[model samples]
Target: MTKIAVLGAGSWGTALANTMAKNEQDVTIWSHKAEQAKEIALKKTNARYLPGASLDSNLKATDDMALAVQGADIVLLVVPTKAIRQVAKQLGTILEEKRQQVVLAHAAKGLEQKTHLRISQMIEAEIPAEFVTGLAVISGPSHAEDVVKGDLTAISIGSTDDAAARLLQAALANEHFRPYTNSDLVGSELGGALKNIIAIGSGMLIGKGYGANAQAALLTRGLVEIREVGKALGAEGETFLGLAGIGDLIVTGMSPNSRNYRAGVALASGKPLAQVEEEMGMVIEGVNTIKAVVDFEEEFDLDLPITRTLYQVIYEGKTIDQGINDLMTRPLKAED
Candidate 1:
């Protein structure tokens, strides 16, 4: 069985780890919080993030990074974007000492706030090259809430390294979980990250009492915006047409389970951004993604009306109605 180390103990991390363990892999999950690690190990439940779901009894949990990663064949990163570099650095030090070569895969979706780097780029910047056998990104329409309930979930495992991608595909796939391999890492990563912004827009529309027509229009336009920006950033346009692109957008943009979408609804309900985030008790990646993508648009001169308008509503204290007005009033152009 493949030995796997899953970093981060949030809902996504725990769900993925439990899946691996149930697949008969030797899996260990790391949580920085000692009490959480103990709880998962002893109680077989991650109560804080993944409520009511029973983890595999065989799964192990640890607060010690070295213990979690020891003899691991694949190191899966499921941490938030903000913690990518820090976790990579720690993993690098441990791997260098162990002299282990392992596949690296990240499931997190978001760009770095300051550097605007993708999750893989941030990991590469901190990790020593010799210890990494391959790098892949896992993203698609799957949600932890559904996945744990044995819902059929399909996701793309993107990597330039074909063998590594196939390896992950084999290790993670089951009757309920399907993993497809893709070579367009940039497109895959961008598709996942960028869609969160649109999902927030979707939530805002719901909050403003808009119906399906508006959501359909928003998603179509948002997809175009994502494709254009991704192309400018060196991703293949066609990648956005696939699961990593439209599939993910559809699920996240429409689902009440999506944190970003909920964040938007809360924002529209007149709650301050800080208050909404506090109430949610999760990272809400779209908020940070907006800041990062706005910087990218400014630097590259890309036109992203939805993202731009959300920025104003979120950070500039503009009302949701005013933001909608601005988007509707933009100079008319042919649908790109």
Candidate 2:
């Protein structure tokens, strides 16, 4: 059996642990809280993040990072993006006794708010390249709640190393949960990160009583903005049109279960972003990713009007009506 260590016991992390254990892999999950570990180990449940779901018997939970990762063939980092650096730092100290040949995969999606670095870059910075072996980011239309319920879903696995990517593809692909492999790490990672911002826009549209036409327009235009940034960053344009890009946008933007979408709806309902997060009890990645997109636009000289307006609405106290009007008034140009 392939030994896999999954860091973080949040919903998505727990869902992945369940998936891997279902595959008969030896899966261990690390949680910072001893109580969380105890819940999973004893009751086989992660009530806080994934209620009503029973974890697989093959899955073990631990608070000790070293014990969770000890002699694992693969390590899956599933923590929130903000917690990634600290987790990687701790892993560095604990994995010193382990061989450097382990495959590293992460499921988190977002760029660092202050540094504008993607999760992959942050991991590369914190973990040695040799031990890193290769990196894979598994993402797409996946909701932790849906996965825990055993609903069918599809995701993309991206890496520069084709062989390593294929290895992950084999590990994660299943009858209900499919995994597609791609080499465009930049496009896949950026697509996953940027879709959260668009999902916020979608929620705002719904909150404001916009019909399906407006929602479709926002989703399409959002893809355009994502593609523009991807192009500026040298990502393959076609990748944006694929599973990790448009597919992810459609699911996240439309689904109420998406944390980003919920965050947007809360914002549209006149609640402060912080208050919304407090009520939701989960990390809304789009809130931070929107700031990162704003920074990227300024740094790269990209004209992402949708992103700009969204940023203003979220950060600069602009009204939703004002933001929509600003987007509507942009000079007409030929459709690309």
Candidate 3:
């Protein structure tokens, strides 16, 4: 059995741990809070994160970082983007103390603020190279709510190392959960991260009482913007057309299950960004990601109306109505 350690006890992390354990892998989930860990391990449920869901009996939970990764062959990180550096630093320290190496994969989907580094880049910078066999990212349209319920899901395992990607694929895939290997790590990571911005926009459309026509337009244009940004970052255009790209965008954009999408809905209801985020009780990656993408747009001098509008609305105190008008008033251009 592949000994897997999942870092984070949130909805996504807990769901992933449960799925892998059900697949018969030896899986351990680690949470920073001892109480949360005890709840999952002893109570067989993570009510705070995955309420109404039961964990697999075989899955283990712990608060100690060292204990979770002691015999881990594959370390899958599912923490928020903001926490990646800290978690990677802690994991690196534990690996160094044990003198052990393992393949590392992250499922977080956002770039770091100011630095604008992707999740994989953040992990690589913090983790010691000698303690890592390879690095990969698992992403696509799989939502935690659905995945934990045994719904059929498919995701992309992206890595520059073919062996590393294939290893993760073999360790995670099952009848209900399928993973496809892809070498376009850049595209895979960018696609998932960038789509959250559009998902927020999608939610705003519904909240604002817009019809299906507006949503179709938003998605189409949003994808064009995503592809453009991915291209500037050295990602393959074709990857944006695949599961990690369009697939993730569609689900996260359309589904109410997406935190970012829900964030948009709340924003459209005229709630302040702080209040919306505080009540949601989850890290809305798109809010932070909007800043990063806007930075990218200015640096590259690219036109991303949706992203810029979001930044203005969230950070600059611009009203949602004005933001929409700003987008609608932009100079006409042919669709790429």
- In candidate 3 the C-alpha lDDT for residue 330 amounts to 86
Worst 10 residues of 1 by lDDT: 290-299
Q: What are the per-residue Cα lDDT tens digits for candidate 2 across 85-188?
A: 99997787666556446788999989997898988889888887777777888878898899878899888998988887887777666787888999999899
TM-score of 3: 0.98
lDDT of 2: 0.88
Model 3: residues with Cα > 4 Å off, grouped in runs? none
Error of 3 at 66 (Å): 0.5
Give the per-residue lDDT of model 1 (tens digit) for 97-200: 99999999999999998788999999998998899999999999989989988899999988999999998888888999999999999999999999999999
Q: Please list all clashing residue pairs in model 2, or write none if there are none.
A: none
Clashing pairs in 1: none
Candidate 1: Cα lDDT at 285: 90
TM-score to native of every candidate shown: 0.98, 0.97, 0.98
Candidate 3 clashing pairs, residues 3+ apart or interchain:
none
